[model samples]
Target: MTSVTSLPASEQEGARTSPEDPEKLEDPEKATLSTDPSETSLPNNKRVEQPTKINWLLTCVGLYLGALLYGLDTTVAATVQASVYEELGNLQKLPWVGIGFPLGSVAVILLIGKLYDTFEIKWLIIGSVTLFEAGSALCGAAPTSNALIVGRVIAGMGGAGMYIGALNYISIFTTSMQRPIYNALIGLCWGTGAILGPVVGGAFSDSSAKWRWAFYINLPLAAVVSPLYFLNFPRYNPQPEHTALEKFKQIDWLGAFLNASTFVLFILILSFQGPIWRWAAPGSIVLWVLFGLSLISYGLQQTFSILTSPERRLFPIDFLARRTLLLMFFATSSAAAATSVTLYYVPLFFQFTKGDNALEACVRLLPFIVPFVFFVMFSGGLLPVVERYAPWYFPAGVLMIVGGALMYKVSPNTYTAAIYGFEILIAIGTGLVFQTGYAVVAAKVPAHRVAASIGFINIAQIGSICITLAIAGSIFGNLGFVKLEHVLTGYGFTDSELRSALAGSFSPVFQHGDARARKLAIEAVVSTMGTSFALVFVAGAVTLVSAFCMRWEKLGLQTTAGG
Candidate 1:
C-alpha cells in the first residue's frame, strides 16, 4: 500500500506530456515545468536545450560518489576509535574526535543550502570537494589527536555542502519521472557508506599505522568525483544578478548563530551530564535554559521576518507554515533517530550479549544492513506505481515500531534466530522511510530553490540522529553504570575499579575473575541498552503520528513575500 513519493510536478498540474516509464527521463532542456512562465527568466532559445541520456547518467554517478564519501567518512572514523585513543592518550577528550565533524557540518548545513540557491551549484560542489580533500590530507598527516579532530570538522563542513550540492544536481539533471530511481541511488550510496564504514574501518584496526588510510581512502574518491562533476554537470545556473554585498546581506546570521549555539549546548550537556555532572547540576540546567531561550529567539526572528519582510529571514516562515513540510521534518527526524539508534546500539547488543568482537558484531549486522539497502531501492522502484509516499509511511513506521519493540523484548537468553528476525524487520522499515519524506519535500519545493528545501529536511534528519544518540547515550551510561556499580560492589570490586570500568564503557566486568560477577555485568549491560531501544519506539510513534498529518496532494512552495 505504499504511495509514490514524488510524481512529475507536471502530473500534478495536468501538464505531463507523457506517462513514460519511471526509468526514462524527459528531455531536460525541452521540458517545461509546472511553474508560472513568468517565473522562468532564461534567455530565448536557451530553454530548449535537451540533456542527452549520457550526461544524465554521468551526473548520477558523480552524485552517488559524493554521497558515498560522506557515509564512508562517518563510520571509518569510528572504526579507528581504539587506535585513535591509544595514539592520542587523551581518552577524556576523545569524544571531540567524533562530535567535532557533525557539529561543523551542522553549523553550516543550512547556510550551505542557501549558498546553492544564491550561487551556482557547480562552484559549490567544487568548493565542497576541495574542503573534503584538504581535511582528509590533514587527518592523514596529523601528528596529534587535536589535529585529527580539527581535520574532521573541516571535512564535515565540506561534506555537508557536498551532500546538498549533490541532491540539487539530482533534481536538476533528472526530470520528475526519472528522480525516484536516482533518489534510490543516493539512498544506496548513503546506506552502503554507513554499513561499509564499519567494515572498512575494521580493515585498518588491525594495525595502528593502517588507521591513517581511513582518511587517505577518501582522497582518491574525492579526486575522481569533483572534476567529473564540474565537467559533466550542465552549465545551468539560474545565475542571480544580486551584488556580492547584497547576497551577503541576505544571510540570516542571527538565526545561524542561534541554531549552531543551541545544538552545541545540547551536545555538550549530553556528552558530560551523567559522567562529568548530573543532569540537575547547575551547569546542565544553565545550558538547558539557554537552549530554550535560543530556540525562542530563533522562532521570533523568523516570525518577525515573515511579518516585516519575508526576504530577510534565515528560517523561511511561510515555508515552515506548510502542514505537509512540517510533518515531514519531524517525522523524518524521528525515523532518522530510529535508524541511527538501531544501527549503533544494536551492534553493541551483539558484542555485549554474544561476546562478538567489534568486527564480528558489525559483520553480523548484514541481515539488517542488506535488507535496508535493498528495500530503500525497492521503495524508489515502487514509487512510480503508487504515486504517493504517505501510505507507505505508516507501514514503514509500524515496522520500525514493531522491530524496536521486539528488540526491547530481548533478554540475555534471546535466541539467535529471533535477533536476526528483529534486525531484518528494522532494516526493512528504515528502507521504506529513509528517503520518503525528503522525496516529498524535494517534490514540493520551488524548482529554483530545491537545494535549500532539501537542506532543511536533511538538517532535521542529521540533527535527530545526533540528538537521539545523545539522549539514549546519556540514559545508557547513567543506567548501566548504576546497575554495573551495584553488581560489582556485590562482587567486592573496589570503588576505583568501578570508576575505571565506567570510563572504559564497563566492558571489564565481563573479564572479571568471578564468573557470577561477569554474568551479572552482561545482564546489566543488556538492560541498559534495552532502555535506549525505548527511544527508538518513541521515535517510531512520532513518525506514525506525523504520517497521517502529511498532505497527500502537491504542496505549495510555501513562498515568502520577497521570494
Candidate 2:
C-alpha cells in the first residue's frame, strides 16, 4: 500500500540495470524492479543492486519495530486511562488522553506526507524515531495530566511518520511483486502490536513499575531496533534539482495549517459535543463553527490558493478525481472504523459481563487476535498470486457483518465459546482487508504519488479510530446511563452513581451493589454495548457497498524477468 521515489536518469545512468541482465539475486525468484522507462526515477525509488538476504531482513526488522511502536501506542492509552486517572485525579479529562495521540497524527499527516516526498527519507525516519522516543520519555516522567497529554500528542506525531515510513521503506526495498507480502508483514507487526497494547499496559499496571512502563517500554525497543536504520537505510534525494532551502520554501505552510486546524476542530467537536458539553453549548457551537470555517478554507486552499500547486499542496486532491481512488479512500476508512470499533468494545464486553480486569479482558481476546493476524498474513501473501484485489472485500464485508451481528446479540449469559466464535469471525473479516488499501494504492497509483497516497489512506485509518471511538464512547455512555436508570430506578441510585457504574463491573457502584442490582446493571451494560456494536455492523455495510462499486481490476504486479 505504499511506495518510494528516486533520482533522475541522468544521475543514475550507471546504476540502471537492463531487465534482460541475468544477474543472480540472493533469492532466485526475486528480481530488481527498474524505474518506469517513461517516468523519471525519484529519490526513494532509485534502483539499486539487490541487498543480501541478511541486510533485507535487518531492514525489515527495523521497519517493523517502527510500526510496532505506532500500533502499541495507539491503544495502550485505553488500558492506562483508569490508572492515569487514579494517579492524576482528573476523571473528567480522561477522553483527551486517547484523543491527543490520533489528533496529533491527523493534524499533521498530510504535511508529513509532503515532507517524505521532499526530504531525505532516512534522516526523516531518524528524526521521527527520536521525536517518538523523546515523547515517550516525557510521558513516562510526566508530573501533570496536561504534560502527559502533550507527550501523547508528540508521540502520535512521531508515530505517524514512523508508520508511513515503514510503508515507504518496503516500497523502496521490494519490487511490486514482493510488496504485497511485505506490506502484509507490516500489518502483521502493526496488528500484533495493537492487539498486545492493552495486554502489555495491563501487565505493567498490575506490576511494581506500574503504568509508566507502557511509555518507557518504547525506549529499550528503539535502542535495539534503530541501529539498522542508521546503518542500512538508503540515502537519496528523488528531486535532486530542488535544493533543501528551495524545497522548504515550496511547502504549502498555509495549507498545512488550515488542514491541521480542520482536523483538530472536528476531533474536538466530536470529543466534546455529547459527553462533556451540550450540543448547543457555546463551547461546542464554537467548535462546530470553527470546524466549518477551517474545512471550507482548506477546500478553497486546495482548489484556488496561489500558494498551492501540484507539487506543494499537502493533500493529493487530484487523486480524488479518479473513481477508483475515491472508492478506495472511503473503503479504507470504513474498514478501519469497523476494525477499531470491534477491537475496542470486544474487551469492554468481557470487562462488564465477566467482571474481568484489563489484563483478563485482553487475555480473552486472543481468539480474535490470533485469527486476525493469521488472515492478515494469509491475504497479503495471497494477493500477489491471486492478482485480484477488488473481490477480496466482498467476503470480508460479509464476515464482518455476520460477526458484528452475532456480537450485537451478546449478553451476560452468553457462553465463552460463543463469544470467542463471534470474535473469530470479526477478526478474520478485518484482517483480510486491513492492509489491502496500501497494496491497492501502491499498485493503482502513479509511482510519484505513492508516499502521499499512503499518507492519505493513513489519515483515514488513524482519523477513523479517533472519530469512531469518540462516537462509540458517546453512544455507550449515554445509552448505558439511560438503561441503568430504567433498570435500577427502584434501587434509588443517584445519577453520579449510575454514571460511575458505567465505568465497568469494577466500579464502586457495581462492586458494592447487591447481587440483583449487579445482575441488572450488567444486563443494561450488555444492551448498551449491543447498540455500540451496531456501529461496526454499519461500518461493514459501508465497506460492502464501497467494494461492490469498485471495478474488478487486476493489480499489475511484475513477477517475471524484465517484468
Best by TM-score: 2
Q: For residues 1-563, could you state the per-residue lDDT of candidate 1 as single tens digits?
A: 11213233432332222224232222322222333322321222222223456665676677788888887775565556656765665554555665666667777787787776666667788889889889889888889988998898798888887787877766655555556666677878977887777667657665454778878888887776666776666544443466667767777777778778878787887777766777889988998898888778778877876332465455555657666678878877877778777776766677667876556767877898899999888887776557667877788778889988988878789997898898888888778878766667665554543555677787887777667767776777677778888776757775445433433333345456478877777787788878888877777788888887765654212221110
Predicted model with the maximum lDDT: 2
TM-score on alpha carbons, each prediction = 0.85, 0.89
Give candidate 1's TM-score. Answer: 0.85
Q: What is the TM-score of candidate 2?
A: 0.89
Cα lDDT tens digits, model 2, 60-129, are 7888888877988888876777788778855556667777887788888888888877877788889999
lDDT of 1: 0.68
lDDT by candidate, in order shown: 0.68, 0.77
